[model samples]
Target: MALQIGDTAPTFSMVDSDGTLVDLSALKGTKVVLYFYPKDDTPGCTAQACNLNENLDYLSSKGYRVIGVSVDSNAAHTKFKKKYNLNFSLLADTEHELVNKYHVWVEKSMYGKTYMGTARTTFLIDENGIITDIISKVDTKNHSSQIH
Candidate 1:
């Protein structure tokens, strides 16, 4: 089922790019920007990651915690974050549990071929861990203000 606004974000514990285990339940006092992207280092993904990187200070000042989730492994995430100087955490979801729980794991078709992959979706979660907004219209070029 698609997680709607006001729904409680599924509690998950995933390894971050730095190999730290981050549990959603532990961040109850802060707003969270949980973004799910298709992959790492790709054009759109890079743009989106950069946008978040540039505005991280602003987001943090507003009491928001930004986290990116993808099917990429910890090693890949570490390389991508280091190469791009990303300041936030990229959660590794190799098992696809969180992806499926949030319903971002979707069927996509490109170049006349179809495959199952994550859609570029984002969830704006509140301090109480309830989803406040859902951004399924991710255009990488304009991702910065999409959270606002």
Candidate 2:
């Protein structure tokens, strides 16, 4: 079942681009913006990440830490981050563990070809680890405003 707004955010341990282990449970007492995207460096994904990167201070000011998740490998995430200068952590869900745990991995369609992929979604979790909101239809360019 899809996670509901009042549901507790699933705890996960994933590796970031720098090979640092990031455990969601460790981020207690901080609001989290966990976004799942299809791929790193893609047009829409890049736009979304850049928007969040540009608004990192605003998010932090609101006591929110942003984490982007994708099935891309850490090397790909490193390249994307370096290329775009993204200022937030990008979790490498290469094994689809976190994505599946969050239920973002599902069947997707592109050009009428159905295949498994990451659905662009964002979960806003409060300090207590409760989900406050879920953005299923993300606006890539105006994402920060959407969250704020």
Candidate 3:
């Protein structure tokens, strides 16, 4: 089931692009914008990440710490970050741990072929770990406005 607003955000501890551990519990004192995307370097994913990168200062001003989760390997995330100059951490959920916890892993269809993949979803978690919002239809280019 998808997580709902007001539910306590699921806990996650994953490796970032730089190999540092990022845990939800470790971010308790700050609001979190946790986004889950299908892959790194894809067009939609790139646009979303870059859009967030562009508005990082604005998000920071609003006391939001942005994090992106994907099934991509840490190496892929590192390249994507360097290529796009992304300002936030991209968590590598290679084992689909966080993705499954957040219920973003689902069956999808494209070109008449169906397969299981990561869904584009974002969770806005409050300082107390309760989710304030969930963005299921994320507008890649104007996402920060939605968060604000």
lDDT of candidates 1 onward, in order: 0.91, 0.92, 0.92
Q: Name the 10 consecutive residues with the lowest summed lDDT in model 2.
A: 13-22
Q: For candidate 1, write residues 1-148 as lDDT tens digits.
A: 7889999999998778787778899999999999999999999999999998898888888889889999999899999999999988999889999899999998999999999999999999999999999999997876768886
Over 84-142, each residue of candidate 3 has an lDDT whose tens digit, in order, gives 98978899888888888999999999999999999999999999999999999999988
Error of 3 at 103 (Å): 0.6
lDDT tens digits by residue: candidate 2, 67-111: 999999899999999999998899988888888888989998889
- Candidate 3: which stretches are off by over 4 Å? none
Q: Could you tell me the lDDT of residue 30 within candidate 2?
A: 95
Error of 3 at 89 (Å): 0.8
Of 1 and 3, which scores higher on TM-score? 3
TM-score of 2: 0.97
